[model samples]
Target: MKAFQLVSPGKTELRDVDVPEPGPGQVLLKVTGSGVCHSDLHLLHAQQLPFPMTLGHEPAGQIVALGPQVNGWATGQHAICYIVWGCGVCRRCATGAENACERFPRGLVPGPGLGYPGAMAEYMLAPARSLVPLGDLDPVDSAPLADAGLTPYHAIDRSRELLTPTSTAVVIGVGGLGHLAVQILRAITESTVIAVDLDQEKLTAARGHGADHAVLSGPEAVPEILELTHGRGADVVLDFVGVTPTLSVGAGVVSSYGHLTVLGLGGGSVDFSASGPPQGLPWGATVSRPYGGTRRDLHEVLSLAQRGLIKVQVERHPLAAADDVLARLERGEVRGRAVLVP
Candidate 1:
């Protein structure tokens, strides 16, 4: 199988590697679709892991083989890989919190394309436990729903209780996750959604997807968001871009008792002052960073896609064009999501 592997930091090699076979409780998926997440660049640059590592995490395809002890799964079944593999008996895994797998600390993150060899090649080996039925959804487009969709879904799930008809939700950095966040908020709740982005194109995309208001992120962003909410500010701020500028905008526009959930890896940080939050936040407001979604989150996110309630915009490329796709993503040329089809 030919794979696009990170032979070294900043260098990718398209080389042939042995296709893997499934072990007990595992399944082998024929590589169909894989998403190039922005975080993949961070993973490549961090070099925290070994060289020759595969870098895709969002994947979906059809099962071609199943190992022993794996029941109720058949070959040729269309499924989306869950992306998080956890110890079967652990409490976290028992409740579909595999993203927080206990075995993770032991260097086991059976999520193919990360700790495990990825679907960037012709074949992928993953745990049968990670397979979710894709049903009639296009496997290629559904790949981003696993991460880009699920990430915001998990963030919104936490603040769902706070969203009322009178509430306002602000989404900063309406790119991949940000654009999806807009749709998710509109689909599941009654809160008015506001999207902010430096790129006017993305802001336009956000509005087309269902954001009630879209603002060009800049010095005037805070005031515009405040105006949109009639000076009360946003009930929840989802910052998909974690740089200082966006974070500052997020802090400035979030209402009191609001929640600021930062999900970007832009290598930026915020310094909390003596006051609870940066600006308009009330005494009870909070800020947090949520990780990837749980298994249930994936299922729900996929269901949203299956029902046509949410859709991911993607630029498709052949597996051989992985390098070009990553470069375009880093340059922000790829809109919404980029999927590598093998």
Candidate 2:
């Protein structure tokens, strides 16, 4: 089987590798579609990584075989692999909060494409419990839902109470996950959704996806968001671009008692001071940096997709074009999610 492997820092190659067989409680999948993420770009440029590993995390495929002890799933079932492979015995996992599994980094770790072999290949192996049934959704287009959709859903679900009928929700950086955040908010919440982005096209797309207002990200972003909310500020601010500018705007515009969730891997930080109002979070405001979605989140997003409530805007490419797609993503040239069909 041919797989795209990241052999070293700042490099990747398509190499022939032996097909892997599923182990106990695992299933081998015929790779159908794997979504390339921005995190993959970070991994490629990072000095440290689980070297020589196949590089993809958002996977949707058909089951080709199931290993011993695997039950309740069939050989031809279509499924999307949940990215967080957690120890089921842990307290967090017991509540289906595997995204924050207590055992993680202490002998447990992130699933495929981050530390383990991923689905950017002809075939891939996944844990039985990590598989979520797709139920009539196209595996190719459904691939991004595993992350691009699920991540934002998890973030919004956590801050759901803040998004009341009269409340306001602001989404920053309407790119892959940000765009989905807008759609998910529109589908499930009555909050007025406002999208902010530096790109005019993405802002336009966000409005098309049900955003009530589109604000170009700049010095005016904060004032516009505040003005739109009638000077009370947004009750929920989701910053998918966690850079300095976006962080500043989020900090400036989020209302008191509001929830600010940062989902991007952009290494930007804001100063905090317990003493005052202009330095950090305002009185009663709360902030969180959320990881990927739980198993249930994946299921709910899939349900939404099945009902025709939300859909991923995708650009399809062959598995061989992984590097080229990565280049486009890095240059901010690709819009929406980019999926590699194997």
Candidate 3:
């Protein structure tokens, strides 16, 4: 098997490697499509990950081998691999909150492509529980649904209880996840959806996805959101970028008792002061950081995809082009998710 190995920051090479066999409760997948995400760029360039590993994680493929103790699945089954492989016995896992599982979290330790050989190769092994069957959808597009779609789904679903037809939902940073957030909000609720971004192209894509309004992020953004909401502010604001500016904007435009969900890992922070609302704003803002989705959430996303209710925009790249894909993603040149084909 040939794989792209990230030996260290600023370096990645394609090399022939031994194909891994599935252990107990695991399965080996013949790699079909793997999405190159922004996080992969961060991991590679920022050296946020340990060296000498494969990087692709958002994968969709067909099962070629199954390990002992795995049941209710078979070889040749097409599936989208769930990125978060959690310890099944954890309390969070037991309650379908595996995204928050405290024990044996997959992403925390790094495996395949990160800590282990990732899907950038011809073959990859994953826990059977991580595979979600994709019966009819194309694997290339479905690849992003694993994280780009699932992350926003979990983030938005957390605030679903607060969203209403009369409420306003603002998505900050209308990029990969932000664009999907707009569509998800449109499909699931009647809330007025506002898309915010520094890029006009992304904002236009947001409108195509279902945003009622797309506002450029700057001095005018707050006033624009306020005006759109008739001075009430947004009922739920999801900051997909999680940068200082976006978080500040989210906190600034939230209505009283509104919820703000931050989904980006940009490492930016915002402060909530006790001083009387600046500029006469009266809202109380809470920032909730959401990571990947739980198994159930992934299932829900797959169901939506199966029903053609959600669509993913992706640029396909060959496994050999992993480095170029990462370069483009790091420079923010990719408009949508980038899927690597083996």
Candidate 4:
């Protein structure tokens, strides 16, 4: 099988490698679609990941083989694969908190392309526990739901209690996760959604995904959000960018009892105030760092796609063009999510 192997930072190649067979409790999948996420670039360039890795996590494909002891699943079944491979007996995994499992470094999530060979090739292996049947949705579109969709789903679910019909929800940075956040908020809740980003293209996409208003982050962006909320500020602010400026914008526009969820891994910080006037807005703020979603969250996202409530916007690139896709993603040139067709 042909695979893109990240031999080291600043180096990757399309080389023929032996097809990986599923281990116990795992399954082998025929590669169909793998989304090129920003984290892949982080692993490629940031020196944060181990060397000689595969770099895709968001994957959707059909099962071709199953390991021993795996039941209730079979070959030829279309499935959207989960990247996390938790130890099923751990306290976190037992309580459905596999994302918090401590047995594996940086938690149990496979990191797909990071730790193990991911879906960038003709064949990949995954735990049968991570497979969710894709009954009616297109595999290309469902690929992003594996992470881009699931991350925001978990983030918003944490603050679902505050996102009431009368309250406001602000999504900062309408990129991969932010775009899906817009649609998820609209489809699942009645909160008035506001999207903030520096790119007009992404903002337009956000509006198309059901954001009631899209504001460009700048000198007047906060005032626009303030005006949209009738000066009370947003009730829930989700910062998918997690940059200093974006975090500042989110902090500037949240209401007193609002919740702020940060999903980006850009490595930035935000200062919070408990009393007195806030820095950007007139309210108290709390920051939440949500990892990837749980198994249940992944199931809900898949079900939502199966029901036609949400759509994944994708740009398909041939598997050989993986380097070019990564370049474009790093340069912020791709719109929506980019999926690799193997």
Top of the candidates by lDDT:
2
Task: Tell me model 1's lDDT, rounded to 2 decimals.
Answer: 0.86
> Residue by residue across 151-261, what tens digits does model 1's lDDT show?
999999989998888899999988888889999999999999999998988988998999988899899998998888899888899999899888888888777778989
TM-score of each: 0.95, 0.98, 0.94, 0.95
Q: Write the per-residue lDDT of candidate 2 for residues 65-140, one digit (tens) a residue.
A: 9999999999999999999888888988988778888877554357889888998998999999999999999989
Question: Rank by lDDT, descending?
Answer: 2, 1, 4, 3
TM-score of 4: 0.95
Model 2 misplaced stretches (Cα beyond 4 Å): 105-108
Query: CA lDDT, every prediction?
Result: 0.86, 0.91, 0.83, 0.85
After superposing candidate 4, which stretches have Cα over 4 Å from the reference?
48-50, 104-108, 273-275, 279-284
Cα miss at 244, model 2 (Å)? Answer: 0.6
Instruction: State in Å the error of residue 234, model 4.
Output: 1.0
> Which order, best to worst by TM-score?
2, 1, 4, 3
Best by TM-score: 2
Higher-scoring candidate on TM-score, 2 or 3: 2
State the lDDT of candidate 4 residue by residue for 173-245, as single tens digits: 8888888889999989999999898899889889999999989888898889999998998889998877888
lDDT of 3 by residue, 1-342 (tens): 988878888788998889887899999999898888777766777556666777787888899999999998999999998787666687887876766777754446343455566788888999888788998999677888988889889988888888889999999988778778888899889999999999999999999988999999998999999999999899899987877888888878888888888888788887866677765335566667777878889899999888988888888888888888788887889887888998
Q: Let me know the TM-score candidate 3 reaches against the reference structure.
A: 0.94
* Segments of candidate 3 deviating more than 4 angstroms: 46-50, 104-114, 279-283
The deviation in Å at residue 25 for candidate 4 is 0.8
In model 4, what is the error at residue 17, expressed in angstroms?
A: 0.7
Q: How accurate is candidate 2 locally (lDDT)?
A: 0.91
